[model samples]
Target: MAFSETVKHEIMVKSARHCCVCHRSKGLNIEVHHITPKGQGGDDSADNAIALCFDHHADAGHYFAGHPKGSKLSPAELKKHKESWFSLVSQHKIENPKIASVEISIMNKDYPGFFSPVFIRETTIYTDRNSMRKMFEFMGKNPDSYVEEFKARFPQNDIYGKHKMSKIKTYDDLMEYFNGDMEKEDREKPNTDPQPHKFELSPFMREYKVINKSNCVLYLKLTNGDKDVLEDYKLYLNFENVIEADSVTKRSKFFDDYKYSYNVFFPENNRGEFIPARPVLVQNDSVTLDAICFRPDPKAKFVNLNWELFARGVFGSGTIRINIKSSFEQHIRERHVEPSEIKPKFIRILPKWNFE
Candidate 1:
């Protein structure tokens, strides 16, 4: 009999969506296998199921035929592997529940007497098991091929910097190289120029409004007002008291006490991708943006929070400071209160033409 949904979910969760035998993530392909053949009286229980990647599942002396009988993995052997994998996954999740994502913003830094527009492509990488496994497999198989693919995706230019191809032999080497690059970038200074070109808020930006605010939820709308095309515009929020929580803070003292986490949603078009703490591309004239502050302290009656918004794009960059006073009591009392629309009190825009 086929495995039930509950059994499948249990197996996947326990194994952390990875192959039990090889400990490989489920990026390439993962399959659920029966420890004991149903014909031998095995029921569809999670204990009887094991996860395996395509490579290990079909390998000789494992699950398929054409291997010596003694070399084949028995049901007991599969169970042992599954138990070990589950234990490791449980420990990992306890130590690190969520992975932090990285984003490198690509922008043109304006330098005096230089009219050339520098092409900057910021790459974001998530260091999850699946992502790590994919990088390991690809780089280990052929580092040159991986480098070529990256170059194709983000073409290097003379204004920014050259793309140095990495020569990595093992998974450890690849990870070391990646971490080194991230450290170097972190040490570098901010991309924005010291003397930014200033401009008044465009018509679209002037018309922007705050639709509503509830218990930790803020809704917004943005419309493109410039005639020139705007690509890869981002909304950056820097919170005052609530530091953006991440897995790195799992051991920190403030991890539990931190009352809020930030996330964005594009309600107008579901197709748009929302990268945490990164900009979402807006192509249309208008789009609805939702900022969700989750995991509020239930005991607290009111939460006073402050954040700043930094908007960046090819056209220019701008910054705005905002303060919000939210009360759970008020929200509870007036659940159906109309949205409180507000304008951009003040906006400072740095245009691209000034640099040229």
Candidate 2:
């Protein structure tokens, strides 16, 4: 959680692996040193970073207050060196083709957190009179802690099925009917409301909440190479080799629900509006799309997200390969990540009519 991958990439490209202090190319033997120590309240930001060679880093990092041998590099001095080198690189003192080559990379490891979707399920029960009465009476008394144990297994919220909203009350309603001639008039059974003679029914409702899961959340990085500014760009994407079992990332109803040919989402979205990750870009600017959580489908063995970006006078396209297994591994901390196999808890019953 130090300087973001985007910030580090930008600083590295700006410095070209050269030590800002000694001005020597260290190749990969360079480090982005913090101008202000973190414990001293330094923030993980580009302006607070300065690239340095190993030797200079050690020199700048080592200093004993009581046994001071020589003056260490000052924060102001580091900032000046970094600014001078960055300006020189950008102003053509040493040309870097990377400056003009747009690049995109998925920094999954760089991101520390992941997004998770939720599940909502509801089931209805049906049966004949005597069976239903027994069931309700059982429900009213909750023998053997069946209801509590059942909920403990599935872990869910409920509706009127187990509360005051129910049409039948085990004693007040059912026994009251039993005290009347209604049973004799009907005869077949007592408490005959929607006869619970059978103890089975059909599935009623189930839902998955995945809209936010399709957001662009991660240390996903994109850099603009051209010196000209990029403006008013919309990103278009499509998934391939997907199945119904896959997570909503692939099954996105975006095309059908929103009339977009490809899956489209606003960058850095907040209630469908843009934040920092705007639809605009400037020269040598690297953007970390961290505002939302747009990820690969969780059940597909392998998937591809083909993307196309278009601006007023610019167009770019590429494909992002998704490894389903790796996707779940990446979010091992999630409570209910796909494909969830918590041995789902449930009580089965068959119904006659469909529930809406």
lDDT of 1 by residue, 114-188 (tens): 111222222333333235456647667554455445545645321234433334444444344454542355354
Q: Give the count of colliding residue pairs in each prediction.
A: 2, 22
To one decimal, what is the Cα RMSD in angstroms of model 1 from the true structure?
Answer: 28.0
- Misplaced by over 4 Å in model 1 are 60-69, 93-356
Q: Which tens-of-lDDT digit does each residue in 1-356 have in candidate 2?
A: 68875666667778866788988876557789888767667799998888999988987775334336658776777888888988887887764423234566677665434333221222322223344346756669543344344445643322323432132333334333333322344333321112111222236533333232222233356678877677765454455543211111222332344233112243221111222346678888877643223333433455565554555445455666654432221211112212333334343322111211
- The TM-score that candidate 1 achieves is 0.27
Q: Which ten contiguous residues of candidate 2 have the minimum total lDDT?
A: 328-337
RMSD of each: 28.0, 18.9
TM-score, each model? 0.27, 0.31
Q: lDDT (CA) for every model shown?
A: 0.42, 0.49
